[model samples]
Target chain A: MLNIVQRFMKRLVRQFFKKKKKVKIGLYGPPNGGKTTLANRICEDWLGEEMGSVSAIEHETREIKIKEEISVKSGKKELKFNLVDTPGIATKIDYEDFVKKGMSEKKAKQRAKEATKGVIDAIKWLDEMDVVIVVLDGTKDPYSQVNITIVGNLAARDIPVLIVCNKMDLKKAKKKKIEAAFPQYDVVPISAKTGKNIDKFYEALFVIAG
Target chain B: MSLTLQFVPYGEIENLDSTAKVNKLIKIVKEEKIILLEGRIEKNEETLLIKKTMEEIGPKFKGIELFVMYPKDEESDPIQRLKKSVVDMLLGNRQGLTIIGPATIVKEIRKDPDKIQLLTKNLSKRKKTPASRSKSTKKKTKTKKRK
Candidate 1:
């Protein structure tokens, strides 16, 4: 009787899991482009929990933060999405800021070099992701080095990419030039800070995920 | 003794006082004849020089600790293996890094000044003068002409 009960329990757990499709997405952009803000928003909305820290400091996230095994309800079936958040990709650092802020020159230089490695390592994550949600800071110029490099690398690989033009809540956001600069991309302008247009963003992702 | 020369990336040179200070405190390795020579580069192109040094020595040195002193990036984990290597190299008691005598190291570093300069400029640490790449390309032309 105990053996039958154990077998029944095993079957129950297996049945509960059911059939689910995993959608692996890599979220990337230049450092400070609000990649984490978006990732946190997604997890919080879908999973009702804060997954990571959202900071304003440049390269605040020095490591590739992964929020995996996220369960989202898609119609009648259950879906799983693995989201990987990576460091920003700013190739240049304003050394003057480091000095004025009382940051040691050595530490600043070391940090700048670090930002580069973090970016490169993050980009490498693209090869493993099913889709790459490349974040963009609309407040900054669209023709920045990190943006160009990220888009260029994505195009070369032919990976499915979606440009998340975040920070729309800021008055200085310029969406047109960003679209003009990269005419060939599917760009979605959303404010990760204010949660504007997030539902639409999720809807687009669901279609793509399907 | 083997000589070891350090060419820190230009982006990294701004903290010369810190990098150099930290570097000086490290114990020098003597087994692989390690001599650590260092210079603060201001040009980005000089990075190519540093990467070249790693590529050249990386093969013979087997593991990076044997020769690379500042090869690890700052973003690496404080407890990871690579960071430990950097600390080991900086502290001068190279667990795996071989120390060449300074005299021997200087000779090795000076052997290819022109080649080194070319690779250094490729690093883009210095100002991107339009002529940087052309300058090296000119040398290639001369070599081709001689051939």
Candidate 2:
């Protein structure tokens, strides 16, 4: 009788865990490199609503922002992804915007200091990620601060890093340059603004994200 | 077998002391096959991080988001809702997901950036965050305490 109860409990627990399903993705890139644009593109298909802010200002994102519960469906399989967008990565930070909000210059400076933490935060995500979308700017070459660090770091973690070369609509986009630099990984040249190569991007994500 | 994990830095982290947020995150992240948290967070944000780290790695990898946050605003208080704004920019229906700071802020983000450096080192070196460190490894020291 005890064995029967144990078996029943085991079955119950198994069912509970097996029924659960989902996926999470972290968006990363340099300042003004269009990280949020990619995230918005992903979620737009899910909720048909634009998520996150896109702007020309550098370091627009200060802290780590996570969007919980994004439902992504690939045919019969479904995934719940929590999209987290990042702040820009530069060598220095400006506290003026923060200070304008009534914070003391000292606190503003301190807050400005904290804003720079995004770079390290970007690295830490590798251990915690299953799939890394290294959003790239097609208008520019692939070798730069954020690109080098992002690709190099993702490769080190052995995490599947998908190179999304964004802004392909621009005439200056040179996909070959980035593809040549990181030939080891899969590079998908795309335009986040127009949703070009989005389908291909998702197909790749579905396989690697698994 | 080693659980392969991947990560990407995207957004920022804030809202200390919100267990509900963490719990909700845990629920969502626990569903993945593996979980990884990348990038740098402030000293004050560590506790909140552990809370979510527990969430993202609940069961463990194969299907998880490489969530990353780039910080922009940095006020000590919730005055401008920088956290919210950051989220808004990253995932909450905004135009661009970026942080606005000066040159000092850029170079400064990399200083003594052990956590940040740990991440970069782990990625570039292909080692674990603490495992890579021969140093007694920084304990789960509280990030920056609320001023």
Candidate 3:
């Protein structure tokens, strides 16, 4: 009788874990590089909702936000994963930078503290990521210290990466520049704000994370 | 493995004038070498670089690539990470290179991160004879294009 109950409990636990199993896909990058915007775009496409709010201000997302069971289907192919949107990673964060953007001193300092903590939390969570998408500004130069560090850590961990070169609708957006910068990784150029070439972004995700 | 060159700015990179730094970057990239930078460039400087590289140099040069490093906190231990996670029930903290090379010979940059693939074929490096070139260029418009 006890053995029957133990076997039943074991099967129940196994089913629970199997139901909860989902691949983790993380969106990571610098502040205002549109990590949240892209996250919102993906969630809206699959889940019919947004993951989090976005702002022009830096470090607007000071905590890790997650949306689960986002299953993307392309024809017969289906990819299901948990989407994690992390705070922008910066080597330095200063309250004065926020102050210059017209934020009050007290709020700016508070934001800085939270943002700094957020950065650490993002790094800690890297170990749990099954795949990572490093979203970047296509108009900006790809060769920067922050970009290197993020890619390097991913490389060290052997995690798959899909580089999203966002903001391609702008005249200054140069997807080719980003391609040249990180020739090793696959890069998908898209305008998250305008939803340009988003289909290609989805296609690349199937190839990369699927 | 392919040949690569790397550059790291030591302390006080900010003291240098932004324009001069961009000019220096342009000169380095034009040399057709794969180079890695130590840190992120300023936003205005990054914009200036893309504008200048595209407009002045034209299609021959491939665009710049960026890689950002992950930040490290005070603790390196796994136990400490878990402990902090528990403490984070109390407190919190957070978040997140340059790769430059010429396009023609350097084909793809790989996961090795620093390694670039170079073309084994020497077709682009070959010199052309005028008569042979003229014979190949049957179109008159094509003949005058390069000159």
Candidate 4:
């Protein structure tokens, strides 16, 4: 009877938190910064599936991808939220560049138009984000305009943010640069490609989302 | 490392529509050169430029880097306010320029207190020079090429 009562109390607490409004978590970053890769990692770990495809090509995620009801557990604490993987934010997109990548002119132009729409949509979607994870390539300079924009937008919206300095598996990955770039927020260095130091990411997410 | 800097000049804002201006900007950026844009584009125009620019980028071009500077204003329209916040988010770390390209130079557009700055660092000497100005003479060349 004691064990049964304990299980009953746990269920009651779970249901109570579950009844609260769902939190929306957005993954935003520049092209090839591992936003989708990190989303895939989170989804694979919790939801047992992939979020979207990743590519070396720029703007591979030309659309906003979403997964709902992702419950991440760290210790006894459980945090549930929706994961939104936005298109890579960029200042410019050119089809001629795509043409050089071996794509036909027509297809490249089509991609350009879609990617433009995707960026606008991603910015618009910012209103809906409850919490955001600004992912960055740890090997690259964290002070780029794209990185600044992601953080600025989040701050403007008064949304809580966690900076994920991704690609730590690379020999050149520097987590300090990212931390130095935004000293106000928490920065987690992880490799979404190789799943390195992901547990810390989960712990960070729990604190931000909880 | 020894580097050759290419400077792409901006045109009159009154002359070109957002799309035309962005298209021209993309063309210049495609040459793997840094291009500077000033008060010619507004908040919406910048958004449109980003949209159009991303659409044209391919595997060869890799990506384009943007740096912007705006006066710190306490009073702005809702949209302007949002753009400022967006700009802050996009251009978060402001120190010196950062390089993230080689295949195509369309990299680094910076704005300053009084003037706009661009640094187009071409990594591969594969492409021929396309009527670009040297880093030292960027100011003079920009004045000479102005519309």
Question: For every model shown, what is its TM-score relative to the native structure?
Answer: 0.51, 0.49, 0.56, 0.63
lDDT of 2 at A97: 54
lDDT of 1 by residue, A1-210 (tens): 674787577546533443343557888876678898999898988878776786655876766888888876657755577888887754334443455667788776565555546655665576666678988889887764346556766664555678888898988987886897687886888998789989778766766554
Q: Write the per-residue lDDT of candidate 2 for residues B70-96, one digit (tens) a residue.
A: 443445688578666666546532222
lDDT of 4 by residue, A59-166 (tens): 788899989989988778888889999998876677776878888999988887787678878887977777899999999888776677678767744578999999
Off by over 4 Å in 1: A1-22, A74-78, A93-96, A102-110, B1-147
Candidate 2 on A96-125: residue-level lDDT in tens?
Answer: 655676679887766555555654465455
What value does the interface RMSD of model 1 take?
13.0
Greater lDDT among 1 and 4 belongs to: 4
Candidate lDDT values, in order: 0.57, 0.55, 0.71, 0.73
Among all candidates shown, the one with the greatest lDDT: 4
Candidate rank order under TM-score: 4, 3, 1, 2
Candidate 2, B83: how far from true, in Å?
A: 52
- The complex in candidate 2 yields a DockQ of 0.03
Q: Give model 2's docking category.
A: incorrect
Candidate 3's residue-wise lDDT over A1-210, tens digit each? 674787577557644553577778999988889999999999998999998999989999999999998999999999998999999876445576699999999998788778767876787788778789999999877765567668766865566899999998899999898888788888999999889999999999999877
Q: Give me the runs in candidate 3 sitting further than 4 Å from their true place.
A: A1-20, B1-147
TM-score of chain A of each: 0.79, 0.75, 0.90, 0.88
